[model samples]
Target: MKEMTKKIAVLGAGSWGSILASVLVENGNQVMLWTNSEEQAKELNEKHTNEHYIHDYTYPKELITTLDLKEAVTGADFVLFAIPTKVIRPVAQQLLEVLKELSIKPILIHASKGLELGTHKRLSQVITEEIPEEYRSGMVVFSGPSHAEEVANKDITLITAASQNLDNARAVQKIFMNKYLRIYTNTDVIGVEVGGAFKNIIAIGAGILHGLKYGDDAKAALMTRGLAEISRLGVALGADPSTFMGLSGVGDLIVTCTSVHSRNWRCGNQLGEGKKLDDIIQNMGMVIEGINTCKAAYELGNQLNLTLPICHAMYNVLYNDADIQEEIEKLMTRPGKSEIEKYDEC
Candidate 1:
């Protein structure tokens, strides 16, 4: 059977978004990449490169770039969001108006990770709330351990496409899977989202451990306990515990924590080296999602009465200017408990 080509509109022309749009185009799909910057759009259209985000790489010439959201999404079969979590709601609101005006229903998928700052809602929840049911086919979260740089370099990578609707998940899997990239279908949307979002927090901690010149033993312990915190918060929020063992869970946690490509880990490393959070963020020139996510997780943990020590520690370091060494000492000196006394508490 011949594969049918579909039109994909990818919002946000950042590193991940541009790379994903290129992947879609390479898979024989018509892709329209939407960017807020007219300069970016012009450069992408003419030069076929996004130098600011992904340097020394060329995008597919067939991939289209547009400054107008409506123009990009007008006839797209899928509207994939690759923007930051902070801007998702506003962009979705804009999308809602466009979808209404056009009277077109496209499957909405988000490649972004992290919960909303004030509401602590998942990206999926934010999108669902902004875009009415009548304006979209279904919602899907595309996430896993893959990084933009690796994916752009054509490195072998695997990811999960998650949705409540099995058919929708399968459809996304079929669309995105190629030789260089593999896609798995998962129906546990909550688990996938939670795991994806929470892993960034642990990654930052891992970076801090490395920055402090901690040995493998300490880093290993941090990752294990961090996973515990993630799984506990996820389970409390209605995610499947076993999902943490999957690609979106432990898989993502390992990569983000260990990789040099991870912004969160890098941010944490700088904090470990005694740099101020505000200064580090200003220098990095990219959004460090884990910082904001740690804030959300801290507030959420208190509200749910969950003991998220690592998250709280990260929150203190990032927001409250708490001493990193003191926080580490605090975590180590805490009263002990059995490794698996309770499944939920773990």
Candidate 2:
């Protein structure tokens, strides 16, 4: 099939959104980057760089950015939400209102990776709830081990485009696939979403280990057990067990935990070094999804009656102000069991 040019509005002019906008523009799409901050939008349009988010990388000159919601979404072929998970609902609501005014129905793609705080709803769920059924062409989540800073520099990155609808997943795959960036499509939205959200928690723990001067042996053990914990909760919540092994699952988990580009890892590293959560967050000047994801996953695990010890340990450190070393000891001292407990019963 011949490639058709598209007009894509990428909401949230953060690092990820800006990277997506740049990629779409490179693919010959008319791209508009939307942000709430007029000053940031103006700076992007004029300077072709989002210095605050991704350092040392400049956006393509053709990439357009706007603060006007109506102008961004009007007649857009696809709307990609790359904003923080916490504000996903509000942004989706605003987009829905704009789409209603323009009478446009476009495919929705979200790259944000965190569950809602109280509701524990996936980012796609929040988008769908805010956007009326008729006005949305489809909703697909694009996730994996992608770090926006590296991706902006055209680093080799692989990501999954996941949705219940195969067509939507494939459509996203087409728009994003390039020589440097590979896109894989999957129908397991639940699994993909779970992997993307929960891995951040594990990454935080990984950072904590690094901060505490733990060795590779400790990191390896934590990652292995962490995957088990993630798979358990995900499978209990209707995700495919094998999805945890895919790019969005173990692949994402590995990268986020080890990379210096990861915000969650950086935050966790600080916490491990005895820094306060508030201080770490304030100094970082970026949204650390793991901080909130830890809380949401903890609540979700309790509700589902799943044992997520690693997640629990991280949650205790962040929310309860529990000692890091104590939580580590608690995790290390946990009773031993079969590695395949979930499947042995099956």
The lDDT for every candidate, in the order shown, is: 0.93, 0.90
Q: Return the TM-score for candidate 1, rounded to 2 decimals.
A: 0.98
Q: lDDT score of model 2?
A: 0.90
- Give each model a TM-score: 0.98, 0.98
Give the worst 10-residue stretch by lDDT in candidate 2. Answer: 337-346
The per-residue C-alpha lDDT of model 1 at residue 12 equals: 96
lDDT of 1 by residue, 1-346 (tens): 9998999999999989999999999999999999989999999999999998998999999999999999999888999999999999999999999999989999999999899999999999999999989999999999999899999989999999999998988888888889999999998999999999999999999999999999999999999999999999998999999999999999999999999899999998988888888898999998989888899999999999899889998888888888899999999999988888454563
Which segments of model 2 are wrong by more than 4 Å? 343-346
For each of the candidates, the C-alpha root-mean-square deviation to the true structure, in angstroms, is 0.9, 1.4
Q: Tens digits of per-residue lDDT for model 2 on 229-260?
A: 88888888788998999998999999999998
Worst 10 residues of 1 by lDDT: 337-346
What local lDDT does model 1 show for residue 120? 97
